[model samples]
Target: MTSGYLWLKAIHLVFVASWFAALFYLPRIFVNLATVPADSHAERERLLLMGRKLYRFGNLLMLIGLALGLWLWLGWGAGRFAGTGWLHAKLLLVVGAIGYQHVCRAHLRRFERLENTRTHRWFRVFNEVTVLLFAAIVILAVVKPF
Candidate 1:
């Protein structure tokens, strides 16, 4: 592969890594934020703050990766997103990830009610989505569905 390909892949990997790491932690933080006891509202606050940071940073990485991927797919090649099936798969996974991020943001807003009603199981479901998302992203990038 050419140096440009190598650089593109490198940036994509970095962005993927950052996205997944944040994806993993953000949900856990959400789980914690949701389950925190009424008496421990302070802890809930902290978790919410941390989750916010994670979600924000994760989105930043995801966006940057999207830009790099688009550049690599279009400008580097014949045209953007022309014949890259693998890149298409990766793009789909990113869309899923972005959807999950939006869900997290919505839930974060609900936390303002201080209801603390969501259970660990609820978070587990969110966790499942991220896990699947991360797996799909990795597979698409590495396997390059071609």
Candidate 2:
């Protein structure tokens, strides 16, 4: 691999890690927010603030990661990997991750408006999606089976 490509890959990995951390944590905040009583407005507000900040940071990370991935794919001859099918699967999972990020943003908005209705159990389940998706993505990228 070219040095330039390696650098881009490193950057991509950094941002992917940052975004996944946010993805993993944001939903846990939601789970906590869901359980907080309406009377505990202070705690609720604090979690909302954290969620908003995390969402912004996560969005930035996602953008940087995507940009670096594009550079690797189009600028560094990563097209050669296209025939392996793993890259395609990775791309699809990345799309799912983006969709999951959007859902988190929507939930953040709902919480901001004091309109969230989902139970803590629901959010706990939702939080697990990131774990599953990230694991699958890592496996596809590393194994490249097929």
Question: Which one wins on TM-score?
Answer: 2
Compared to the true structure, candidate 1 yields what TM-score? 0.85
**Candidate-wise lDDT, in order:** 0.78, 0.92
Show model 1 residue runs off by greater than 4 Å: 78-81, 84-86, 115-117
Candidate 2 lDDT trough over 10 residues, lowest sum: 137-146
TM-score of each: 0.85, 0.96
Clashes of 2: 0
Please write out the lDDT profile of model 1 over residues 60-92, one tens digit for every residue. Answer: 987887788777767777255456887777777
Model 1 is weakest, by summed lDDT over 10 consecutive residues, at: 74-83
Kindly state the number of residue pairs that clash in model 1.
1
TM-score of candidate 2 relative to the true fold: 0.96
